[model samples]
Target chain A: MLDYKLLHALATVVECDGFERAGDVLGLSQSAVSQRIKSLEVRLGQPVLIRHPHLAPTPAGQRLLTHYQQVQLLERDLRGSLPTLDDQAPRLRIAINADSLVTWWAEAVATICQEEGLLLDLVIEDQDVGLKRLRDGDVAACLCATPQPIAGARSVALGEMHYHPLATPTYIERYFPEGPCKASFQSAPAIVFGPHDQLQHRFLAQCGYHGHFPYHLCPSSEGFVRLAAAGIGYGMMPQLQVGELMASGQLASVAPGHFLAVPLYWHFWRHSGQLIQRLTQHLSRVMT
Target chain B: MLDYKLLHALATVVECDGFERAGDVLGLSQSAVSQRIKSLEVRLGQPVLIRHPHLAPTPAGQRLLTHYQQVQLLERDLRGSLPTLDDQAPRLRIAINADSLVTWWAEAVATICQEEGLLLDLVIEDQDVGLKRLRDGDVAACLCATPQPIAGARSVALGEMHYHPLATPTYIERYFPEGPCKASFQSAPAIVFGPHDQLQHRFLAQCGYHGHFPYHLCPSSEGFVRLAAAGIGYGMMPQLQVGELMASGQLASVAPGHFLAVPLYWHFWRHSGQLIQRLTQHLSRVMT
Candidate 1:
């Protein structure tokens, strides 16, 4: 057995690069840090340091420090996820993309946990980046498309969301008047869910029309769908999100057969974790 | 969040059934368990039980209880493995099978932890059932062939271990100079590692024989290997356990070109953790 408390002190010293500075972080005297390190080596029954005026960890000590870092990360995640299990008040923290948050995704997240009694800390950003919150120790888990296992984390696939080239029936009729999709879409003004979204470009590439379109950058997802429904321009939208508008004739998909599709995936830490798994379960059922 | 103390108390109640018996086990008044359950539901904002003369948990309550049981098992395992990290000489608790303890496996386990500065407590039982020690909160983890994933646990395939029929070359020559493996084997005693071991049965079945072997059960892994080495009787042994003996010609494998390969998997609670992974790393390198 080794003294991790002393090892932690040693790590702090290596991190601070001075005994006095390490003592300041550890709230110990410089002499105490040095004494602790000495005692740790004795207890290990092995020399674990090559002490110098400028503090540095030995090979064995460095290995112990790496273990210490992993333990620290695990402890932080446990602390964040188990606040209520202890004397502390419970809080629910979630990391999700802005597009999903602004769309119907929040409604799904809210429905699952609201009645269960917890305050949620919603971390909203782009889907591509928001998922890093889980890895960076900012949140317990996240929803992402990258899909590869995150070291110790697990992922479940949520099915594809089809996004067809959509526009208002009148916008299609009046703008072209050459009937639906007859006039090339290469010159149509398109609505974007966000500046980062490339669905329109992808659709045009598939249509073999490499020409660019004038874009309306409506960052909000629901707003983009509304702009298309209001007959402003053509945009790709998921059927689940726009079926009612399509039914009411406010929006008519342009060449409904040609659609863009993106598959979604949910990733989380693999544990007997009720919260993350339950949330993933509900979202997968509804999305798929 | 669920109250762990309450769930444990409820489990105690279910195990005992009567409130007085449950109280005795938990060292609380019967009234305390009842009050605890009431408060737990209020705190969680969810009903977990409909108390009667004997308690029966609701569906949500059962799920919560199961999670608590997993937490309890991991906590116990942590306690056992934690002492190993302390050079101050805290009580060391280790989980192992009777067969391994009797065999060279115990020696390996002892030697591996000896220089590491651990105060050891080794609990021994049959490998097939020693896992109950882990699940019931007795030991940290054990070497088990159980392939099913236990709640809160993970499994890794350690690879196949080939067990061949072996005996002292002298004993084989003296007992039956000419092979009448089926007829002579029926009369010759077989050395069994433990009561539940299937190697002898499978071996005999291969020779078109049935019924039980005239058995001498040595319930220790190292002892089983040593017994066969001493010309005690013919028995099946793992290649890793007997590979050195075979190389030295101290033990000759009777079923030379034929053997049974059993793929052993390592299972341990996720929280009990990488200890099992470390063991698997060492065992796989040699076992294969």
Candidate 2:
């Protein structure tokens, strides 16, 4: 029989699409990620990935991932459940993105505790990272960014987290010397939240700029908003993600009507625990 | 950390409802059935059953049984698949009641082969026994008598298998002998398919007859019909099951319009391979 722990490791590696990144997400070493995938392939006697095109999972890999996703959710639900029903509240663990957790998720968890008498634990990470936690047996549910759900989680398009390019007035006046680059400046530098995410690059690429930004790597969604607000550089910020800052004019929209829309998606473990249902019901209310 | 396998065994036992009968249905010794359940509770660190009131599974046991049912279907689908995709015909495994296997299931399988290039491994047994086979991982799909589906399987009401209590006209004339004793004579000696099944008994029990019938266990559906034709005993035979014998006047309806109707249900692996889909589709046509 194949080692289950190795399968879990391989699953995380595929989700992250890079050995080092997957290791970072799963709290393992790069060598450990590589070794686990290697061991899993040796055990299943099949190549589970072609390992290109940004790490597409092979059909066999997809099948195993699907099963793994399902089993992981069930196990999480079981763990979160009260053992055979008791007087005490069940421990409810939820995986959620930094944006939602700091925004409206706390209210949702509070409602559940007050109404249903649930004990809650929250994991606040990036949307993409929250999914990794859900997959790695860390939490019962998560708020994700992508519409396409990670293998086993059931996803609903909560709503898009709309973004508009913004910069401080001084920074725009100094750098652009123009409101927003008219017809795409191929040579302009920019700031971005994280290393792997290319949202800013993609937006610029749409206008023919192919160069990377002198990036800030502000990991948290709130930190990214703060970095953009301080006018370190022109960057993309979600409407809800940076709503108050934009309204206060600490950040100004550089591109008046040209903000690239990054649609946000909420994914939770498929019926894991009562707390997840409570969160999703609440998130759905504000997300739309 | 409980023996998940015991949940499986308990599902099997509860599905069949008797240790010895469940053993025969599962192809295990009665002692093996007891041992499997004992080991399951030991693993679970809890007693799963109270051994009374029709042997109910504990709440945890019930939940695990539901999961086991889903797992079994997924496992069957996985096993039915070939090592690699090829243009060749795929083997399909199905468990069907003897009456259905003999009457309509063959034509349905033939139709599936013609349309989908399927190779079938047909399992013939009683409907109750077929469900047990499904529970034990014997077949990828089954045509069962019960309307309720096994945990992971999908079910459809395939209408009724109209049965007319049949025997040589001479047997009714001799047994009844005179008037005013019709219901009394109907509950007399009967032909049951096998020691494991109680279809005939159910019919009598429903009619409020608490007495046992002096019986013959013919085992095969065809054999049961033939013995009924020759006047060995009265038995409920499906219209498709004894249609030709009745046409030839070799078997005449002993009860005529008063015979009981036994409904047949289609149960297939919820995540079945291509063949199960094709076969169940055709069965809806013939059995309906």
Candidate 3:
């Protein structure tokens, strides 16, 4: 029930960071772009953008952009299927987290892109926030940690991302020679992915360390593992990644029988596109 | 010219998400926390908190939080140096990008943390934005790409992170048998790190492909290289990382002689702490 042109104008203004630049991209005059955004705002009866600090969309504006992106995706998909339309390759926008992108997901996605002659635009975010991007319509599909499906969306369980408390043998010997007790756990530092990443906190809380503890925040999975291997801090590591280190005695388990298993899901908008179907099939087949 | 206590109150409220919870964390009543925030808002003569769409700090609020965090870091460092200070290890926050973290940076950092009995809180962001954290006082120091130093900061040129456009030979033959041209560049997919990452764009622009092109976004350096090796897409890779692979013929340069040499600098507050000095010395010695 909204105008695609107006919605695009709004999204482009945010993306371009100025009306003049958005105009250049959309082939409209600066005033025309401004007027289109103004018209859209009037239609919605609310402001869609915050003008200062940076050109960013308001919640309502984000919702509108999401709608626009969804419509654009479906239309593009439809156009790709109709042989009479054009031979232009279709671009597929996807939302994913850093962890999945680095591990098993990238290979599967790249193979598909090459074979199908599809263009992929990947929006990388934390798994916790990946689904929010999907809800906002910033990306047509997302791989996230949330197991529950959003309304009018389809979700497929991609199995658990198992994490165990791992530390270098030297770090364990230096900090927890008596094993990982509450006392040593408090004194020893832990590595965290980011402020929002609660993997270490969850594991510690499960191990009964409820109070504030020292931590080193390494925001990348590979970097975090490298730090853990170098005796910087004890933190959780995925089973697949830590197995070799554990076997080689470079890294050791902090606590026996205590692990955090984060369940992951792939969520996509309710659509009937062959590409989406094939992508889903390919992911489900390979991820498990 | 701002009260650190009030700023702390505001930051805690934003971090904790509710007045009651923030009050619990600060050991104050909910009304006290609210009154402190109100007083601070009055002092600033601007609304600092957004009451709707979940609790978020306004631009002004974010600025105050940055100041508060900076003050907190200095105070903690000061206390750690005092003879009366407790034996608890101090946390040192820093800003860096993913590539540095995954490569040579992590080892040196972990060694410093282990030796100094300090906790590192690394804020990972692109080199372009890494200095912003230093200005905002979110981190005491940052590893960034900016050659010019901010006010009251000292910069040390470490080295250049040289990147070359790399891809598998098979992909090169299939996509660009005629060699690198604007047409082949348009049709062939390129791997990008993230939406914010412009390495590929810079390279393409250098190669005369000024328009938009198909791309696969792989957020990790390691994963990006994996995709390139698997013939998913040609992307920029650091020379140090791709050297072995290139030697083995698993990967080859897309366009020889065309590379991006990103000069990296270490920027830090003009502080005289032995720990900061030692850290800087250690990093310069290792990275250079």
- Model number with the top lDDT: 3
Kindly report which residue stretches of model 2 are placed more than 4 angstroms away from their true locations once superposed: A1-288, B1-88, B179-188, B206-208, B285-288
* Stretches of model 1 off by over 4 angstroms after superposition: A1-90, A102-107, A179-183, A271-274, A281-288, B1-288
Query: What are the per-model C-alpha RMSD values against the true structure?
Result: 28.7, 33.2, 3.2
Q: What order do you get sorting by lDDT, best first? A: 3, 2, 1
TM-score of 2: 0.36
Q: What is the per-residue lDDT of model 3 for residues A167-223, given as tens digits with 9 covering 90 to 100?
A: 988888889988878888778888888656778878878977777777887777888
Docking class of 1: incorrect
Best by DockQ: 3
Query: Could you give the fnat of all candidates in order?
Result: 0.00, 0.00, 0.65
Q: How many steric clashes between backbone atoms does each model show?
A: 8, 2, 0
How many times do residue backbones clash in model 2?
A: 2
Give the Å shift of residue A166 in candidate 2: 82
Residue-wise C-alpha lDDT for candidate 1, range A1-288, written one tens digit per residue? 656788788666765556886786578899998898888788777765555212345556666664564555455457667775443222334565534443455345444533332234444445555465555444556665566757777878776567888887766775656633424564455766543466877887777766545555444455456556645567888776677887887788666578876766676767625555667788777776
Q: Tens-digit lDDT track for model 1 on B244-278?
A: 89999988866567688766555566764434445
Per-residue lDDT of candidate 2, residues A1-288 (tens digit): 556787777676764456886786567899988888877777779976665313545556666765675565455456556456333334345555545543444444434444554444444455566676666555566666767777767887776556677877765676667654543243233545443355776677665665423333333454345444544446777676567777887788766777776655667666564556666787677557
Which candidate, 2 or 3, has the higher TM-score?
Answer: 3
